[model samples]
Target: MSVTRPVAAQFEAYNKRDINAFIDCFSEDFRGYRMPAETPSTIGKSALREFYISNRFNNPELRAELISRTVLGNKVFDHELIHGISPTPLESIAVFEITDDFISTAWFYFP
Candidate 1:
């Protein structure tokens, strides 16, 4: 299976704020992190759900549009972004490590 399909599905869920659907795109042992300081990693579905909820509450109009997607074996590098609050959009690069079940890991960067 190509990473594009899963990534696209994730984007769909994210746009809809469908937490169940969004988290479904991740593996059972999924872990994610935002760069700069990575000591405390977000592990498991519950943690990720909290992250999404907080984000949604903070930025009600947040939405990501894929700028580009590159697949390398089990990994997918997605350059995308969120918009609506500020004039200039916030850029993000999601490094997705996919597994048989779902995406195992994600590392995000904003610059």
Candidate 2:
């Protein structure tokens, strides 16, 4: 399967806030991190689902507007503006590493 398939599915699922579909785009051993930190914010499909449900998907206004995207090998880099999590639109870059057609790891960046 192409890396873009999962990445795009995840992106669409994110906007829809469909926890099941969102989790489906990730691997069983998924890992998510906020950059500059050594520890992952969430790990494994179960934890990833919990984190997004409680902290992200719960916010009905939460959404990410994609500015651009670049794909290289099994990696997908997305530049977007996030809203509903803060007072102002937050600019961010989400780097997704896909393995075996699922997103295995992801890193969030703010610049």
Candidate 3:
């Protein structure tokens, strides 16, 4: 699969609130961080699963509207409008690094 495939799957699964499908898009050693911060917010697939189950998958109305997507080699940058996570929608950027058909790392940024 192309590098962007897993990234695309991630958004689709997220919108559907499908925890299993969302986790499937990531590598076993997947790591997620907040942009401009060095420490990881989540490490490994199990941690990611716990994070989504606790903070995301339970939100029935959660959705990410893709505003734009830029792909450079194995990296995909997505600009989006995310809703249902808070009282109001938020604009954010998600940077994904894909390796061997799975997302290995991700960074999220909000302004």
- Top model number, TM-score: 3
**TM-score for all models, in order of appearance:** 0.87, 0.95, 0.96
Q: Between prediction 1 and prediction 3, which has the larger lDDT?
A: 3
Lowest summed-lDDT stretch of 10 residues in model 3? 1-10
Tens digits of per-residue lDDT for model 2 on 1-111?
Answer: 777899899889999999999999999999899998899988899999888998999998999899999998889999999999999999999999999989999999997
Model 3: per-residue lDDT, tens digit, 61-85? 8999999999999999999999998
Report how far off residue 63 is in candidate 1 (Å). 0.6
| Model 1, runs deviating above 4 Å | 85-87
Q: In candidate 3, which residue pairs get closer than 3 Å at backbone N, Cα or C atoms, i.e. clash?
A: none
Candidate 2 worst ten-residue window by lDDT:
1-10
**lDDT of model 3 at residue 15?**
92
lDDT, residue 58, candidate 1: 52
lDDT tens readout by residue for model 1, 1-111: 777666778888988888889888988778888886565378988888898888673567878888999989888999987775468888889889888847888898888
